[model samples]
Target chain A: MTFVIQLMSGLAVGCIYGLVAIGFSMIYRAMGLVNFAQADIMMIGAFLGYAILVAAPGIPFWLAIIGAMLGAALLGFVIERVAIRPSVARRADQVYLVLLTLGIGIVLSNGARLIWGADPVVYPTGLTHQTLTLAGYPLPAVYLYIAVVMPALLVGLHLFFTRTWLGLALRAAADDPDTAATMGVRPALATSVSFALASAIGAAAGVLYAPISYVSFDMGVIGVKAFAAAVVGTLGSIPGAVLGGFIIGLGETFGGQLIATEYQDSIAFAIMIGILLLKPTGLLSGARR
Target chain B: MESKSPAALALTGIEAGYVAGVPVLSGVDLEVREGEVVTLLGRNGAGKSTAIRVICGLLKPNAGRVELHGERIDGLEPAAIVGRGIAVVPEGRRVFGSLSVEENLLMGGFAHRRGIAPKLDLDAIYTSFPRLVERRTQLAGTLSGGEQQMVAMGRALMAKPRVLLLDEPSMGLAPMLIDAVFDMISTLAGKGLTILLVEQNASEALDVADRAYVLERGRIRREGPAERLLSDPEIRASYLGVG
Candidate 1:
């Protein structure tokens, strides 16, 4: 019964990491640069949702989620245009871009602190605390929602990439920006759309996570764990991101349960190093070069 | 030839290069009329690919003008140039290796607007390259060299390009595959597609083109009908490697 409970809790956390990792993977694939600010973006979304909830009491939880996603998407557009585009146009080195994104992350995190203050805020427990007994074990309703929502989002994303014209254009841009341009697909526009989509998904993860973990200014570090998950899954594969997130989540949970709870974070990093040494391509197959 | 408009693609005084001040091609002029095949013949360093790059708008000319159907497209981006009905099967068969053969063909149609009439049919592409139909789901990188070239050509055709720019379609192919590629080009031209082919394989290029130009040091040294160029004593001795 304890094991089942642990697994359920681990799965919920893993799904959130998977969502954030997918955003990192998408942006990296499209632009060939990791958006280090992704976690800060997720934090911004959570804070935005909190603000909306406070500004207008009695707003439905689902509506808050949608509003947060749209807000994050708009924020993503602005960040891409103002922060990323200039550096890219100059053809800066990869290390420079990485540093730029790290700077952006710091700015966003501090900006969130300025607006929302440096204290943790509790989100209303809306259907998340409700418990259901399965196999004579108590399971949180939020776990079921997380499991269902993550898989559904993955399926929808898969269909979008496979069936939609815009998704096809994004994939083409990722494959070869030069050839994609020749195919009449503007690489810049495709990149903007990729960032927007990734941000919205990250915001969705934020909304789901808020009720589980109280929203705070320092919530962005969770995104670092998501990055570790991305690396475990390989850098760019969507399925790999999800699998890596789940594996990391389980590892953390079990490590805390069996070993010292203080070292749970270390377990994820150790697994990441092990995977990098053993199978750098990740568990899921990804594009070579 | 029947009475028709001027060349589907025409470039006049095209000077373009990578470096800001150093020009790779100086005053390079080329043309491809409707239903005609033209070849640009040159050695490795002779600016053959640069001419194609400039025509396709991949590299903007430092000083020249390009006209497609009489509309100037000298400073336009590559996507805009493609939207003007020209497609290049770029050098090295640069197919999207990560995508499947079918996905690659579908990407070729990205330029067509949402409500516009479909220009190219998938069935036609599959019929043109039957092997592609058999392996539509396979990743493009997994294909053999000849098969990859077929995908590259099929992808260009899917765009329904009025003028096709083929750069060294014969490079790295076996003798049999080279013959197959030439046959495909002839078939496309027979179907009314204008073609500007750039190649180091002078004999094969001359055999397939209606007109030929020999480029040396970024300038056209000779221009004439393919047969005349092929039979010219100077051309035969210096370029054709025929006594």
Candidate 2:
């Protein structure tokens, strides 16, 4: 019963990491760059949703989520255009992309700090803090919400990629930008669209998380786990990202439980290094290059 | 006897090179008439592939003009040029290795910005490459070289290109496979597709080409009807290694 509880708890958090990892994987596949600022977007998104919900108390919590997503999408699009695209046009080194994103992460994190301050704000997600007991084990209903919603969103994303033309165009851009261009997929458009989609998803994770936990500036620290998940799943694969997230989430939980709690973070890193030594391509690497 | 059709694609003075100091294409000129198959024949390092790159907007020419159906298209991006109906089967059969055969076809169908190409669909592509139908779910990188080539060609066809540019379509293929590829090329031409086929195999290229241009160091050294070029004793002996 404890194991099942731990697994569910781990899965709920893992699904959030998985969502953020999807953003990282999609952006990496499309632009050949790891966006370190992905988690920062999560923090900012939560704040935006929180602000809107506070501003209009009568609005449903879901409306705040939609508004937050729209905010993230527009902000992400602008960031790609203003901050990322010119550096790309200049044909900067791969390291430049990493550095640029890191710099952006610092800026966004600090900017949130300026607005929200250093304190953690309580989130009124309107869900009663009810605990559901399964076989004498207590489980937070919020985790159940994440467990169901995240998978549903992942399925929706899969459908978008496989069934829709624009979604196919995004994947095409990731596969071979040059050949994708020959198929009339504008690399710029693909990049922008990817940024928008990724940021929106990141924001969605943030909104879902804020209700369950305190919204704070350093919430992005959790993003590092998601980044690790992306690396463990092989850098650019979507399904790999989700699987990696779940593995990391579960591993961290079990590691904390069976071993020492303080070493949970290191478990993800240890697993990453172990996988690198054995299968450097990652457990679910789809990249041939 | 020249079966008359207007030039569907044309290039003049296509000066291009990857490296700044070395020009791969210098003062090259070529054209493909509507519903005709034109082969750009050259030996290795003869800028045949570069010419295709320039025509397809993969590489910009340093100095020259490219036109399609009498409209200028030199400065446009590859995506826009693709939207204008120029599709390329690039050298070495550059299939998206990670994507499935079906996904590859879907990628190829991204030839338009908004909608699927009406002339080609998953079923249509599967019909054209029956082997691909059998292995639709398989990853493209795992396929044999000839199979990869079929996917590459099938991908281009999914675009329903107005001017198809094929770069060294026979490279790294078995002799029988080369014949099969050429037969497919001829079949595509028979269906009124305008083709610019680039090849190092002059003999195989000439067998299917309606007109031919001999590119030597980025310049047209010889140009004529394919039959005329094939019959030229000195040309055949010097370039094609036949007499």
Candidate 3:
């Protein structure tokens, strides 16, 4: 029961990490930029949902999530246009892009600090109170919600990528933008769409995560862990992101339980390094590169 | 204002290179009429590929006016150029390593399906390349060089382009494979496709060209009918290697 309980909690957190990792993978695959601001977008999403929910106090949870997603997607589009597009036009080096995203992450963190103050905002009363008994262990209802919903969302994304024309274009554009252009897929449009989708997915992960954990400006650290997840899963493959998330989550949970709770954060990264050293492409990577 | 010409694709005064003020092509002019196979023949580093890249809108030329079917297309985005009915089989057989052959071809049909009815669908493409039909499920990265070249050409044809630009289609291929590729080029021309072929294989290119231009150091050294160049002593001695 203890093992199952730890596994359940790990998986719930892993799904959130996976959600953010999917954004990282999508953007990186398409544009070859690691997008350090991705995690900060999650922080923004959590705060936005918190603000909206607090203002009404009667608004449904799902509606709050949808609103946060749309708002973050728009914000992401603006960021891509204002910050990213110009550098890309100039054909700036990879170091410049990485620094630009890091700068954006710092700005977002400080901006959130200015808006929400330095303290952690507690999640809603309803969330902490709800619990579900599974396999003789009492687990948070939010974990169950995350564990179930994230897989479904991933499945939907898989269908979208395989079946839709836009999705095919995105995959093609990622491989070779010059060639994709010759096929009539606009590279500019594809780049923007990738930003929008990545941001939306990152925002969704944030909203889903906040009810289980406290919302804080510093929570972008979690987003960085998601980056590790993406790397662990192979940077470009979608399935790799999802599976890498679970692996990181489970590793942290089990490591904390077995050894020292203080080393939990370090364990996720350590496992990432180990995996990279051994199987660099990740556990479920569909992409060779 | 650019002149309205009936040529399928035309380039005038095209000056371009990777670095500024160090052009590989200076004052290069070329044109391909409808349903004609025009060969750009040159020695290594003679700006043949550069000329094709300029017309394809990959590199923005320092000074040039490229027109397709009487409309200017030089400064347009590469995607828009494709929409205007120009496609390129780039120098390397740059097939998407991760995608299946079928998916690669499907991506090729992207421009053709742009909110309009598609002219060259998957069925037509598979029929044109029966080898591709057999290997449709295979990943492009795993294919042999000849098969990869076929995938690259098949991918280009998915757009049903009005003008096709081929850059060194026989590069790195065996002699047998080169002969087979040139045969395919002639066949494509026989079916009425307008093509701009860039090659170092001077003899084979001339064999398939209706018109030919010899480029040397970013300038057109000579231009004439393909048959006329075929018999020229200078061309025979220098390019044809008939010592």
Fraction of the real A/B interface contacts present in each candidate? Answer: 0.74, 0.74, 0.72
What's the number of clashes in each of the models?
Answer: 0, 0, 0
* Decreasing TM-score order of the candidates: 1, 3, 2
DockQ for candidate 1: 0.63
TM-score to native of every candidate shown? 0.96, 0.93, 0.94
Root-mean-square deviation of every model: 2.0, 2.5, 2.5
Candidate 3 lDDT tens digits, A1-289: 5898898889988999999999999999889999999999999998888888888787877777788889899999899999999999999999999999999989999999999999999655486568888878998877866765687778878777766788888888888888787777888889998898899888889988998888999999987789889889888778888888988989998999998979988999999999998987777665543
Query: What is the interface root-mean-square deviation of candidate 3?
Result: 2.0
Each candidate's DockQ = 0.63, 0.57, 0.60
Give me the runs in candidate 3 sitting further than 4 Å from their true place: A284-289, B1-5, B115-120
Q: Judging by lDDT, tell me the better candidate of 2 and 3.
A: 3
Point out the worst 10-residue segment of candidate 3 chain B by lDDT: B111-120
* Model 2 interface RMSD over true interface Cα atoms: 2.9
Per-residue C-alpha lDDT of model 2 across residues A1-289, encoded as one tens digit per residue: 5888888878877888888999999899888899999999988898998888778876776778789989999999999999999999999998988999999988998999999898987655555376777678887766666766687778899899878878877877787788878878787999999999999999988987876677998899888899989988887888888888888989898989988989999997887788778888888864542
Better of 2 and 3 by TM-score: 3
> Would candidate 2 be rated incorrect, acceptable, medium or high by CAPRI criteria?
medium
Q: Across residues B96-193, which tens digit of lDDT does each residue of candidate 2 receive?
A: 87777888887777754355453347788788788998898888889999999999999998888998999999999999999999999989988999
